[model samples]
Target: MPLLTINLNPAVDTVCRVKSFNTHHVNRAYEVVKTAGGKGNNVARIARSAGEEVYSLCFLGGASGAWIAKQLTESGIYPVSVEVGEDTRTCIAVVDERDNSVTELLEPGPVISQEQQNRLLDKLLDLLRSKTFDCITLSGSLPKGLTNEWLDQLFAELCSHDIPFIVDTSDSRVLDLLHHKPTVIKPNVQELESWMGTAIREENDMIQAGYDLCRKGAKAAVVSRGEKGLLAIRKECIYKVSVPKVNPVSTVGAGDALVAGLALGFINQLPWPEILRKSAGFGTAATLSYTTGRIDSGSLPSLVNQVTIKKIQPV
Candidate 1:
């Protein structure tokens, strides 16, 4: 079965390389690369690279949107695009080679009209009725003009279908939709801390937060800690995944790659340890490449093997 990914605020991502990257001085970029971007789109790309069929649903507008659609198609992902009036946004990331730092400039994206919002919902419902997907992933932030009520309604409708949902977003509004009980929620450590309104000072605190998310209606919570690897929390057990260190070229889309790996694992019914190991490997591999969302397929297996998974059974 194919996986379905939804990207509400997609963008054309431009990545530039700067040698030193001075704050007040004019910096020259030696290399520049552009690719189809957005959290959901990145998941689609990585999943497709792993030989899974993926369908990407998104709002597209103007020339940039058309280009993204074309690139997704060329990448072997089926695009289900809804047309809008405004052009899609562009995000720029400046990578400093000296210290491996990334500075990003993100646009607010287009304002989606009421009619467009309804059309997107209708399209999603129609697609659900027409095809069977292994899982549905809701990723990224909402664009302007989309309301919290609309998000609640979307979650309600999606839950009525009896399919599993994997949500990966930093938007705090997702806390409200947990009543609908999503299968999995992927949030970075910073995002989790923001949601909890407390700092995760220790491993125990992190584990407690994950369990708290479960009590709030999520079946499982996967917390991504950059460089430190991932922490997977479930009702019965918890997993701490550690990835092998590598010289990272870019950190863009690493979280999305981890989400993709989790989705793939769920789709294939793998054990929790293997699932987390693969997720850590995918995330680590993404950092080895300069392009956003792209991973080194050749090194994936070795990376997977290098991953260390520790499972803890909660008392």
Candidate 2:
């Protein structure tokens, strides 16, 4: 199955190690490493590593965006890109071993012109018309210039043709996209809490929220909780999956990994519980690796055994 990833707001991720972080203070960095990163870009990386054919569709503008395209090309991912007017964005994540928390600086992406947006969407639609994609994943946050109507617009195309889509996003936009009824949707605890517009203090609330989203039009809903693991609702059954203890270096891209795994599960037609295991497996595996969205596939096997499955009912 062909997997297509669309990154609307891409970036060059710069990582550095530091003893400590301080506000309004200059600090020396231990080392600097830059890589192609954006929520969608990282998801493509995960899908590629898992032995899937992926096409990375993104917009490149200025130097950083050019570097992103080059990185994708070198990594063996097919890049279908268009040049924009403004420069792409960059984010810096500083790892503080002393405090065990990373400090992040995020730059909002440059605004894209109307012509640029139309050109990109034209290509996407043209491709969809010509080829059969096993799955289309819309990952990451859309930049400011991208309108809220973007997801709905594509949803119309997919709904017209019955193409399955897996979406991982947050906030009001996510709710807005829910009306399109994507084939799969993944959200972490915090995102789910925000979506519910209420506190998710216990598992019952979490279960209800997942089911509620399914009722809201998601074909299947997967909710990820660090350590506590993943929850999913499909065909009127709720699967509660838990993972064994893990010492996480960071949790930044774990949810993305889960999205990739769930996408694989959907493509493979695995049973719901197996899908939960793999999703939890990949997510926990992501925590074992640091340096930004890089996952060690070797760790997945051991972690897979650590994943326990349970059938849950909401009260």
Candidate 3:
């Protein structure tokens, strides 16, 4: 079955590569690539690369939005776009090859009016009624004019249908959605701490916080800890996933790739171990590759094998 992805705020990401980026000075870039991006859009791309059928629903407006639609279509993703009044935003990622570090400048995105929000929601409902999906993913940030309360209502509607939903978003938004009880939430360590309003100083602290979120409403919480790996807390068990050492090209969209992996595993009903393996492997593959949200297919099998998944027995 195809996975349904919702990206309320989509963008065109420009990735520029520079050997040594000097601040306050003119720098030359050897390579530049641009693609359709947003957290949900990235998930769609990565999931498709992993051989999953995906359908993307997003809001598009003005010239940039039109361009993003074209990019999505070119990427072999079926785009179901809703028209809006404002221009879609653009984001820039400067990859410093010297250090393999990525500096990002993100736009706030278009302000979604109430009517536009309703239209998008209605479109989503129609899609849900017309098609059968393995799962649904809601990602990226909420554009202006839409509050967390609005997101709660939308998620409640999705929950009413009993479809599993995965969410990856900003820290502030994560707290509000916990009440709605999404099937899964992927937040980084710092983001998780912010959502919980506390500092997570160690591995155990992170695990407990993830579990706390699970008890509140989320069925599971996946806390991303960059190169250190992943810590996942579910009702049944907790997972610790780590990848083999490798020099990262750009970390830009690796988290999104991880989300895609989780979606794939959830849709396939894979065991938690297999799920974390895929999640870590896909993330590592993306890091090994130059493109954002894309994994080297050849590297996945071996990379996945390199992923170490340790189950922490619940007391």
Using TM-score as the measure, which candidate wins? 1
| Stretches of candidate 3 exceeding 4 Å from the true structure | none
lDDT per residue for candidate 1 within 1-315, as digits (tens), equals: 789999999999999999989899999999999989999999999999889999999999999999999999999999998999999999999999998899999998999988889999999988998898888998988899988888899999877766778999888889999889898899888898999999887888889989988998898999999899999899989988889998888898899999898888878888888888888999999999998778988889999999998888773
303: Cα error in model 3, Å: 0.7
Q: Which ten residues in a row have the lowest lDDT in candidate 3?
A: 170-179
Name every residue pair that clashes in candidate 2: none
lDDT by residue for model 2 (1-315), tens:
777887888889887777787779997887787889888888788888888887888987899988999888777777788798788999888877675577889898888777787788898888787667777887877777776666578666665556668888774577766777788788878888787788888887887888888878888888877878877776567888989787887676788788777767766778778877887888888887775657778889888878999986644
Candidate number that wins on lDDT, 1 or 2 = 1
What lDDT is obtained when candidate 2 is compared to the true structure? 0.79
Rank order (by TM-score, best first): 1, 3, 2
TM of each candidate vs. truth: 0.97, 0.93, 0.96
Pairs of residues clashing in candidate 1? none
| Deviation in Å, model 2, residue 49 alpha carbon | 1.4
Q: What lDDT does candidate 2 reach at residue 59?
A: 81
